[model samples]
Target: MQIADRIEQALDRAVALAQGPGAPPLLASALRYAVFPAGHRIRPQLCLAVAGACGDADPESADAAAAAIELLHCASLVHDDLPCFDDSALRRGKASVHAEYGAPLAVLTGDALIVHAFATLRPVAARDPSRMATLLGIVTEAVGSPGGIVAGQAWECEVAVPLADYQRAKTGALFVAATRAGAAAAGVDAEPWRMLGDKLGEAYQVADDLRDVLCDSDELGKPIGQDAVRLRPNAAAQLGVGGAKARLEDLVRAAVESIPDCPGAADLRMLIKAQTALFFPKQLAREAA
Candidate 1:
């Protein structure tokens, strides 16, 4: 099967697993609503690709890792759409969970997805329970606590939080987790492979910041100008749009360079290229007129 097709299959199965069979009708409905017709599932796709490049990727455990990480991502999006947060009514070009299911159900669906992420990991956990436990701990830490995405969100409330800290927590954490989880799933235990997570995570953050400035809401499928509208600090705010795009290119180059260029990293190199291609001058093509 083609690589993208394989990733899509894993994503579809994850959407189903997140729903499960015995969930309450309300919960099942929420699950279907939150995940179906979702975004690209890029996080899990990145994980699977990295795993495959590195080694066998052990089909048995790779799906578990993909499904678990996807649930985590879906949960984050559900919470992100809450009234207290982005407070948006649209996601992926459709009404968000709260908009369609009501606030209470939306909250529960987010909570449930978080729990299911770990639950989905049980099979891989069985392969070597202790290692799985460690992986879960890393994922949980990234999603919660003082230095994670939850904390990243909380920073907006703070009187003085570093922009780098906020961006890393909010965007970079998941990229880091995806790579780490992929390495674990592949049963590879090298420091270099593990470190790929951090590099990719930071690279993605830079790319996202560039997009928020250059891309329109119609293209992004989320509210546009959110950072500028909210007066939040962004790469575009600190560095000009032209400069932010440059930073993105630099980071992508750095991220790809951090990993040893080899047969294993060939596809990963392509993935990085595809991501950075959209960031700059085209953004001002019309404005230049």
Candidate 2:
């Protein structure tokens, strides 16, 4: 099956598992709403791609890892759009979880998705108990304290924060986790893939920064100028449009170059090039050209 199909199916099963009898209907609906109609599914796609590049000896485990990564990402988005954060009304061109389901349900939905992300991996332990520790560790670190997405979010609350540190934790953590987790799921050495994730994740954040400044809400499906409004770190604001675009291009090149030597390296490189190319908004691309 295609990567997107695999991700959706795994996610559907994970959501279904959470929606058993006696579950709160609103929370269940919120869970479904938060995950469905995924935006790009890029993180999961990267996970699966890295797994494929690494031989994908355990496709089932990789799928679960991918699903878990995506669930965490979705959960982050749910929380990120809450009133306390970006207060975004729309996500993926529709009402955000908090907007559509209300903050209480939205909070529950994000929490539930985080739990379900770990739950989705339970079957993997049954299939190959040996892989559980590594998988759990990788996923946990990506979303947990000191250096995970949670830390990334926490940075926003701090009195002072470094831009690179904030960006890495907030955005790059999961990408690093995705790449590392893919290799771990495939029973390969995951360390070598970290650089690729780091570069790509930073590139993605820079792209988002540029988009925030250049694109309107209608184009991005979320609030624009949020960086300025919230005084959040933004590469576009820090580096000018031209400088940020150059930085983005450099990161993309670095990411492609960082791919570990594996069977699918060439294809992976092509995929990175193509996907990162889309990071440039049409207007930015035109101006750059």
Q: Which one is best on TM-score?
A: 2
Per-residue lDDT over 3-83 for candidate 1, one digit per residue giving the tens place of the 0 to 100 score = 566666765666677667776888888887787765777777777877777784576566677777777777878888899
Which candidate wins on lDDT?
2
CA error at residue 103 for candidate 1, angstroms: 1.3
User: What C-alpha lDDT does candidate 2 achieve relative to the native structure?
Assistant: 0.93
Residue 9 displacement in candidate 1 (angstroms): 3.4
Candidate 2: where are CA atoms >4 Å away?
none
Q: lDDT scores for all predictions?
A: 0.72, 0.93
- All candidates' TM-scores? 0.88, 0.98
lDDT of 2 by residue, 1-289 (tens): 9999999998999899899999999988889999998789999999999999999999999999999999999999999999998889999999999999899889999999999999999988987887988899999999989989999999999888789999999999999999999999999998999999999999999999999999998999888898898888899999999999999999999999999999999998999898899999879888767
Total residue pair clashes for candidate 1: 0
